[model samples]
Target: MTPARQKLLIVTRHTPLPWEDGAGAYLHDLARYLATDGFRVHILWLAPHDRLRWKKIWRLPAPFARAVRLHLPGALRLGRRFVFLAVVWLPFKARALDRVRRALNTVGLAPPRRHPSPAPPAAAPLWASPPTPAELALVVRFFEKHRPDVVITNYAWLCPILDLPALRRTCTACLTHDIGWQRAALSAPGIAPEITRDGEAAWLRRAALLVAISETDAAELAALAPAARVVVAPKACETRAPFAETTSRSLLFVGSDNAFNARGLDWFLREVWPRLLREVPDVSLHVCGSIDRLVTLCPDGVAFHGPVPDLAPCYRQAALVIVPLLQSTGLNIKLVEAAACGRAIVTTPAALPGAPFLRDAVAVAATPGEFAAAIRHLLDQPAVRAATAARALAAVRARLAPATCYGPLAALLRANAVARHDVARDLRVLHASGAHPPQP
Candidate 1:
């Protein structure tokens, strides 16, 4: 008789959102690949626990509690998770977002409405606060019903729950989209460093595998939690044939309205966009995704198209794709996606944290002058552009197929998910970019 597919449950607060896509794209791809590779993959869209921990809530200023109280009635109408998430994340995000808007407002972009999100409790990052009774119950009930062989968490913050009765026997994994403390520190500077570090370290150490999107993260995470296994697996893009090039010198950029995108776009617009305009007088730059709202400038010859349902049309219309990232940690899915779409890309070193092999395949520049020059050269030289795009597409195909990227992970799961104590033999270095030995 054939054996049944082992069940895998992903406990995460993320779903694939078209607008803010990259953050969750790797998890979606992971689920898809694991399912294709013979596991019954199930996702639990975990939400914020109901009721803020009194220890955390009490440390906050009066208004924070007041805001929670004010939101509770309407939130009760919606649900408990709604109350927790909205009252906690929205106020902080809105306040921080508006602060950014206020700063950029000086640079000509209109500021959004202001809501004062005073300091949240010290040391509290997203699920770092103790999970609520309601949340624990939800997980327990879900586990009872599913009985998954493996429990994979979306972030290290959720790793604390691995000890719960329903999950104690299951092989646990944490998907590090980026380092949690680093992201939290950037998003909420008030969070204490020791708290973030200690909390992240404790839970990251708890996981059987810490799946990072980049090799850089794998190194960092391994150092942070020496006992845990760190595997590098990012989004896998299917490479297509080179797209038809156009005489149109249309440049395209797609990103969400986050600090990374804001910083990069602001820099590109202030420094590089003017130089490109001067060289190619008829050149037009197209901006897509929620980043349209966050950019500090909207100069002439630049157009903002808010989140669109389709990107193939945008990629097809472009002469090139630009990823002028100043700061980011994980694999920039856009870079791989652009390569997969058969478009030549121009980006900075900051964008290649995980996927360094593509440096030769695409144009890379650090400064404004060099970046502008690369974009200008790619625009003027169609043959060179075609050759570069072909190289990028080839690289994506050779290095990033789902099977190739996920094969090691499959082996790891088969070996470790059930009998986790036998880690000695299977814990060999296996890279997500098709760098592992063949089965005998």
Candidate 2:
């Protein structure tokens, strides 16, 4: 008989939505690969990324239509929490609503709240808080009943679930997106509780296996928890067929409204953007995705085209992509995406740790002056830009394809499954001999 597919479950608050953000895209690619490569993938997640879509909701319906769409039946289907969300924030999102909601809840009259409400990505304190006891109870019950061969969770914060007694019979893995303490760099002062190195290290130790998104992140994580098995699996991508390079003098930036994108965009506007325009005055920069909401200002020549379901049209129109990130951790998936799309790029050294193969393929500039010059140089020479874009596309085809990126993780899991099966056989033989089963 053919061997049964190994069962694997992903536990995360950051639900996978390929277009939502880099983390979402990473998880989506991971799930797709696992499902195809001998694993029956399951998920225990909180909410779909940004279910509110506050920025795009107005554009969604004809005037006054969506307001009517938020009726009682809609609330039932979405659960009680959706009703609270619709009333407390959707129609007229105001500071005064906070007072109204508080008064209702204080009198035990709050709207039916049956589910966990979605928080804005990376901005809410909820991102750092551990699940309530009741929530963790549900997770424990599911883990015990399912008894998956492997359990992979996205964040170190969720490692609490990885420590369940059931894990002794399962391979627990923590998918480390980045060094958690590095989040302190992007957060506002006093808003986030101190995320120390020791705290991060402690969380990582709960898992038997650790998956890192980059070599740099893996090295740090390995140092943090020397006993935890660490494997580097860079974010997965598809190698797109070579597309004609754009002659249009437009630059594209795609990101979510998270702190990292906000910080990088803020720095770009304050320091790098003006310098870029001084050289290429007629050139336009098209900003895509939710990151637009985080920026307070959009100067002339820069356009914010909020979140879209499709990025193909945006990619096709831009001459080059710019990633002027001053601070970030792990792999910058956006950099890999631009390369996969065959777009010439002008980026900073900060974005290269995850995809070092990109270092030679794209233009790398360190300072604001140099960054602007690189963009200007690519803009002025279409031949050079196309050649560079071609090089980037080639690099992704060779190195960033899903098989190339996800293979090592797959190999490790397969080996563990065989080991687990052998251990089960030993236990059966011990049972026949009236001997106690060995601890896993």
Best by TM-score: 2
Candidate 2 regions with alpha-carbon error over 4 angstroms: 1-3, 48-125, 186-193, 424-433, 438-440
**Model 1 lDDT, residue 185, Cα:** 68
Candidate 1 residue-wise lDDT at 390: 90
Per-residue lDDT over 14-60 for candidate 2, one digit per residue giving the tens place of the 0 to 100 score: 74556768887788778778778888777665533345533222232
What clash pairs does model 1 have? Answer: none
Model 2 Cα displacement at 141 (Å)?
3.1
lDDT, candidate 2, at 219: 89
Encode model 1's per-residue lDDT on 258-288: one tens digit a residue: 7788889999999999988988899999998
